[model samples]
Target: MTVVFAALAVSRHLQDATGVSIQNLVRTLRTVRSATIRLGRHEITLALDIPAAAQAILDRLPPRGH
Candidate 1:
């Protein structure tokens, strides 16, 4: 699924069709942030680490300035 997302992220046709910049997709994938909330007297939070699948996709990408 991460590979599929990465492929879609880099697809010019998809970008043109959706008007979504690849930069934004890559940014979104790279920085999947955690969330926090408070309810009544309790606090709840979610901490997310980059999925191994996503990391693999990212690792295969060419470095910037390539």
Candidate 2:
């Protein structure tokens, strides 16, 4: 599935980009289940807020073998 590939790719990117430990990454993800915000007229919901930074890193990643 694409989901599996994305997760694996991000995991590899995280390993290459950050010194943070795998335990720490997993813990962080566990702790941040979701994030939410509200305004008087509108609301914003982020299901993956905890891993947003990691995903951002993935977004900026160059093609592999570059």
Candidate 3:
């Protein structure tokens, strides 16, 4: 739940900071499949099936940074 909301907030913040939009952020999300919202664990798991673009984004981001 928090991760979902945080994603939303981060999307908005990044959009504002980069002069992008929610659509662009969603487009990025679309680049991933294995990265999912795990209800039981409350974390994102990058399975082997994840898209390359998503993996690139994840790689660019710090593990636990805003």
Candidate 4:
């Protein structure tokens, strides 16, 4: 759900609502690493250092429709 994160990363309300943790988001901001993470019609190119757990969740998400 890279798209979701890209959105959530900007939303203070959403960040509070979901309680989703992105240590990667923090790391990326600090270290300036760049990578591409895509979902559905979205392609996000950010320097976010995604944690293993978040990466796993992204990997496990089903594409579009079953």
Candidate 5:
């Protein structure tokens, strides 16, 4: 869950930088594996499975032609 939250934070940053929606970014990604965060000299790593995460995001989106 923390990994997912971290990924969402990255997505939000990307959205702000590129003006692309998170949904669109996920939809277009061919691979999204993991995220790493560093604090001081330590690093935190989280693994993410691409298909599962993408599907989770897709499931939350409203259906097309709304």
Candidate 6:
């Protein structure tokens, strides 16, 4: 969820800067199937399936021109 939120925020920023829609930004990210995060100390590892996460974010966004 946190990753999705961060992605959404970045998409929003890119939209503002590039005149692109959030949907487009997210769609471009669909190629990213997964990501790994490494944490120190505990050596925690987190894997994210980006397509699913992108879809989840897209699901929450209102349709364009709303």
TM-score of predicted structure 1: 0.33
lDDT of 3 at 14: 61
| Model 6 residue 47 distance off true place after TM-score fit, in angstroms | 29
Give candidate 5 regions above 4 Å deviation: 31-66
Tens digit of per-residue lDDT, candidate 6, span 20-53: 5767765766576554556665554456556765
Report lDDT per candidate: 0.65, 0.66, 0.65, 0.55, 0.69, 0.63
Off by over 4 Å in 1: 1-9, 12-31, 34-48
RMSD of candidates 1 onward, in order:
10.7, 6.9, 7.5, 10.9, 13.0, 11.5
Instruction: State how far residue 38 of model 6 sits from its true place (Å).
Output: 25
| TM-score for each predicted model, relative to the true structure | 0.33, 0.41, 0.39, 0.27, 0.38, 0.34
Tens digits of per-residue lDDT for model 2 on 1-66?
999999889787676666555565666556556767998988998876546755554455467787
* Per-residue lDDT of candidate 5, residues 1-66 (tens digit): 999999988778667654558777666555766889999999999977667655655555556655
Error of 4 at 63 (Å): 1.4
Residue 12 C-alpha lDDT in model 1: 65
Candidate 3 structure quality by residue, lDDT tens digits, 1-66: 999999988787666655546686568667555555678868776665656655555565445655
Best by TM-score: 2
TM accuracy, model 5 = 0.38
Clash totals for all models, in order?
0, 0, 0, 2, 0, 0
lDDT (10s digit) by residue, model 4, range 24-58? 43443344357888899999887667566556544
Off by over 4 Å in 4: 1-46
Give lDDT: candidate 4, residue 5: 79
lDDT of 1 at 33: 67
